[model samples]
Target: TQLLEQSPQFLSIQEGENLTVYCNSSSVFSSLQWYRQEPGEGPVLLVTVVTGGEVKKLKRLTFQFGDARKDSSLHITAAQPGDTGLYLCAGADGNKLVFGAGTILRVKS
Candidate 1:
């Protein structure tokens, strides 16, 4: 089984600051997905990157897939308090999908 390792595990930053979280794996994935989960809600899909060296942006958030498709990163620019949540990375290869431990972000106003 393949697993994703995410770091630094937890992040606390002031509003308007920029931050980056990472997800890495020893195995390459066909596609990678990023999700955000709130207090009482299920994780919501943020973005999916399928091609190597691909980059996608959603407003203040940016997602990037490594050239080998074994790593991914999420960058938040001028993060707001609303960005505080659990960030998860999931990788899919054929019929299997694996998720990282997740990074909890706390943005203070």
Candidate 2:
């Protein structure tokens, strides 16, 4: 079975700080996606990385896919309180999606 493990399950930082979170797996995936979720809401797709070593940026956020396609990372620059949310990494396996344990981030103003 494909599985993803995310590091630092929880985080707390001040506004304007930067942080990076990681997702790792032993199994290779055809594609990987990142999502962000707010309290009481479903996760919103942030970006999708298909090729190995691919990187995508959205404003202050950066996503990277490992060269082996088994890992990924998310970096936030000058985070704001509004950036606080649950971040998740998911891998595509056939018709199914294998998700990581998700990282919860809190940015205090």
Candidate 3:
């Protein structure tokens, strides 16, 4: 079985702060996907990294997949209050998925 572990269960910051979140596992997966969800809405796909050591960017956010395909990270630059949401990391192996507990981020203005 594969499991994803996320760190810094919660984060609170003022506007324009930068934050980095981490997801880790001991087993390798075929691909990794990141999602960000807001209140009253389902998670929306942020990015998917399939290759080891791959990096993807979305505006002010950066995502990286580990060299061993067992870990990933999300970095946000100059975060805004509108960035408040829950961030999740998921591992895809074949058709199955292993999800992390999640990281809740709150940016105050």
Candidate 4:
């Protein structure tokens, strides 16, 4: 079985501070996805990286897929308090999805 492991289980930062979280796996995936989950809402798909070495940016956030397709990272620039939430990384392997433990982010005002 393949598993995604996320680093820095928790992150607490002040508004405007930049941070980066990582997701890694031993298995290669065809595609990987990033999601953000707020307190009461289900996770919303943020981005999906299919090609290795691809980089995608959404506003102040950037998502990157590893050259080997076995790792990924999420970086936020000048983060705001509104960004506080649980960030998850999932790898799509064939018909199954393997999820990371998730990183909890708390951005203080």
Candidate 5:
């Protein structure tokens, strides 16, 4: 069985602050995808880190996949109001999918 867990189920921040969210698991994953979803809208693919120990950066956001392929991290630099939303981490094993508990980020301006 594969499962993903995220820390600090929720987060609220003032505009311009920074934050980090974590995802962990015991089972190794083939690939992992990170998504940010806004209210009333489907999640948008923020990034995907497939290689172990690989890191990808998108503007103020940075993502890293664990060397063991069982963990991941997201770092937001200078968070703004536009960054507020639900962040979801997903692990894919062939056609099956497992998701983290989810993190709700609120950025107040």
Candidate 6:
């Protein structure tokens, strides 16, 4: 069975601080995606990494896939209160997706 593990299940930081979250897995995946979600709403896809060592950035957020395709990371720079939300990593297994437990981040203004 494929499984994804996310680190630092919860985080609280002041605005302008930076943080990095990680996702790891023993099983290889064809693709991996990152998502951010606010309370009472569905997660929104942030980025997808398909190639090993690929990196994608969205404004102050950066996503990187491990060279071996078994891990990924997300880094945020100068966080704002609006950045507070749940961050998730999902690995593609054929047509199904294996999701990490998710990391909750709260940025206080």
TM-score between candidate 3 and the true structure: 0.97
> TM-scores of the models, in the given order?
0.97, 0.98, 0.97, 0.98, 0.96, 0.98
Determine which window of 10 residues in candidate 1 has minimal summed lDDT.
Answer: 92-101
- Model 5 regions lying over 4 Å from their true place: none
Colliding pairs, model 3: none
lDDT of 6: 0.96
lDDT of 5 at 22: 95
| Candidate number that wins on TM-score, 2 or 5 | 2
lDDT of candidate 2 over 30-86, digit per residue (tens): 999999999999999999999999999999999999999999999999999999999
Candidate 1 RMSD to the real structure: 0.7
lDDT (Cα, tens digit) per residue for candidate 5, span 45-99: 8898899999999999999999999999999999999999999999998977788
Evaluated at residue 102, the lDDT of candidate 5 is 91
lDDT of 4 at 86: 99
| Residue 106, model 6, lDDT | 98
- The Cα RMSD in angstroms, rounded to one decimal, for candidate 2 relative to the true structure is 0.6
The residue-level lDDT of candidate 4 at 33 comes to 98
Clashes of each: 0, 0, 0, 0, 0, 0
Candidate 1 lDDT over residue span 1-109, tens digit each:
8999999899999999999999999999999999999999999999999999999999999999999999999999999999999999999979666999899999999
lDDT of 4: 0.96
lDDT of 6 by residue, 43-74 (tens): 99999999999999999999999999999999
**Candidate 2 residue spans exceeding 4 A from truth:** none
